[model samples]
Target: MISLPLLSHAISSCNGPCRDLNDCDGQLICINGKCNDDPDVGTHICGKNPPPPPSGGRGSGCSQYGTLTCGGSAYPTYKCSPPVTSSTAAKLTNNDFSEGGDGGGPSSCDGKYHSNSERIVALSTGWFANSSRCGKMIKITAKNGRSVMAKVVDECDSMQGCDAEHAYQPPCKNNIVDGSDAVWSALGLDKNVGIVGVTWSMA
Candidate 1:
């Protein structure tokens, strides 16, 4: 049961933090455990939150943490910090679909995988570790002045040369922004092999 004071608080504080659905009042919804003022009415869930962390479930650490690989599967199973909304300069590249790199057959964000689609992108472990940014939207701008908005769908494996944050060591030769075939075409790059200097930002 909801009390008068609780209901008043919930109604007046629709955008405030919450622990459960009941914390929100009226049409407002509890999302990512927080009450959202402008939630996706269709889904009744805060549209900002990701689709939950990798198969291992949510983590409680920093976004720079790495993942674990077991039994031929890779899981970004580290405690994650809050997602960062700041934009960063990233080196974009295309991933060959020869292997199940689209987040291991299914997208880590929405659990849907489209091999030939270009609306999806894979971020490095450092970026993906911030679970909040998983399903968040990102704007990518190519050097050619073409820009596209993409959703973060998968985590680019550091072992496969996705580590690009090394300051002194010069990263694994790539920051590895793995985009879908459509992304490559949108950036006007050849899908066979290409690199583009791009900037990305999250809202």
Candidate 2:
């Protein structure tokens, strides 16, 4: 049977914590396993509280503690835990490219592989034309397995060994490297090559 507080017990006050127990009637105030009649019991906890640390999940720890490579070809496992590897990342380069209606020629990029390249400028030609391609991200891999993302720029028109405006001949000149000689020299592509492959996502 359960016990109910009498009319007199209801008016009593509890001065401490209330505990859950057997054989207690109504809201019993239990101070270290004892009950009181003071009404304000177990309400105040005084101290300073601090913000919580980040929870365990993807992308959170990296931002605070800086970036980390767990199972990359270079890092290859952190604390012996295998991370998901990207088996296929898009490749960018132009090699032996012929003139197409898209307006471009072959590039001297013979054996080079590039992925998402970063960019200095926020606005890029590809992205303005196609919002699907928002960022200037590129990744390149060397034969020795060295890979990094390069920045995208307005130099899509600045081909391997050419000027920025295709020597100002025609706006439709398919010669990207015709004016950007210095950049071409940097990439080590000769004028003989006609196509460079740049893989940018549509969105």
Candidate 3:
């Protein structure tokens, strides 16, 4: 496992608001006006410092989990309420990222090749559209309480999706994430579609 060294400054140092990505530390980015750490191999997959619980979802249930608070009030522009903690609220799908008739073939955002052993995810176009999220890390917690940290390796597009301007189609609704076989196994999910309550956050 790879271990990441700590930043000279704590993550909270940059928690203050910022308007530009350049305003935050080189390893951090500005999201929602706050400087935050860019989830990486050390914090997520390396078993070093794990992130907090879900706090950015639907009800107060979200706050009990991660650092970010969830709820309609927490996110003014959010599309839908975040699911309750460990509830089967988020829907999970699967994809092979295979070549040929699989349509888009290899990863559309980055050309990097990810084998099944890698814990990778094909995020919805809405999220994948931001190329900056390409190599970052995301923490995915399943309803069963099994969680895994995965890399943003590819894009998950539905009908009329995966364009340079946009990453998904309207039909993708609710299904914002599609994991590789390795991801499915890591979360203790079955090979088929898994209706899981997922809580994720950047490291």
Candidate 4:
């Protein structure tokens, strides 16, 4: 958070809105004679915060069912409407990431986007391993004044339209993308296949 200027010398200093002031306006509480309000993170109203209700897709965006690895991260750019056929027609307990994974034994969240250093430093050492990125749930927007909630745990590699089998799941299942479907469906992608600006707050 940046500091706002104060009207230290403005008590009886500058006559009016004369000069010396950069972009101050109105009567906010000026500092050093300048005024300011606050900075906005990124606001967008989407559909639902918990999204499709909590029963569906809670941590899929966290890290592929629940691993906390980059393998589960998704940065969707949803469509203006619902998905198409062969599109994401299923919910959580039935998605790709929901499939059995490696020897991880299933965690509650699948890594979405990450703040690696946060988790890595907290690790004890040889317990499991240190994976970069640590995704947390974030609120985003879609249609109208709706807010969609999604997760971001790991760093994505920018690869779309492909599938990666789970190396340890026997039928080895996990978040494997055949196209942008999973990503698109999960985040309710925008018209363009790109990333959306979501305001994240831990739930």
Clashes of each: 3, 45, 15, 44
Index of the highest-lDDT prediction: 1
Residue 135 in candidate 2 has what lDDT?
38
Q: What tens digits encode model 2's per-residue C-alpha lDDT throughout 1-203? A: 96644433232223323343222222333456444421342211121332233365243221111111112211111111112124322223332122331213322222222221211111121122322222345343333343344333333321111222223222211212121332233445443454443322211
Residue range 43-66, candidate 4, lDDT tens digits? 121112312322433433221211
RMSD of each: 15.1, 25.9, 14.5, 19.5
Against the hidden reference, what TM-scores do the models get?
A: 0.47, 0.21, 0.48, 0.21
Q: Which residue pairs come into collision in candidate 1?
A: 60-79, 61-79, 61-80
Quick one: ranking by lDDT, best first? 1, 3, 2, 4
lDDT score for residue 138 of model 4: 35
Candidate 1, residues 48-163, lDDT tens digits: the string is 54344334333422332223323444433222223444556677877533244523445556656566565768776567764446877788878778888877777664422222
Candidate 2 wrong stretches, greater than 4 Å = 1-124, 128-135, 140-148, 155-166, 172-191, 198-203
- Against the hidden true structure, what lDDT does model 4 obtain? 0.27
Residue range with the least summed lDDT across 10 consecutive positions in model 1: 165-174
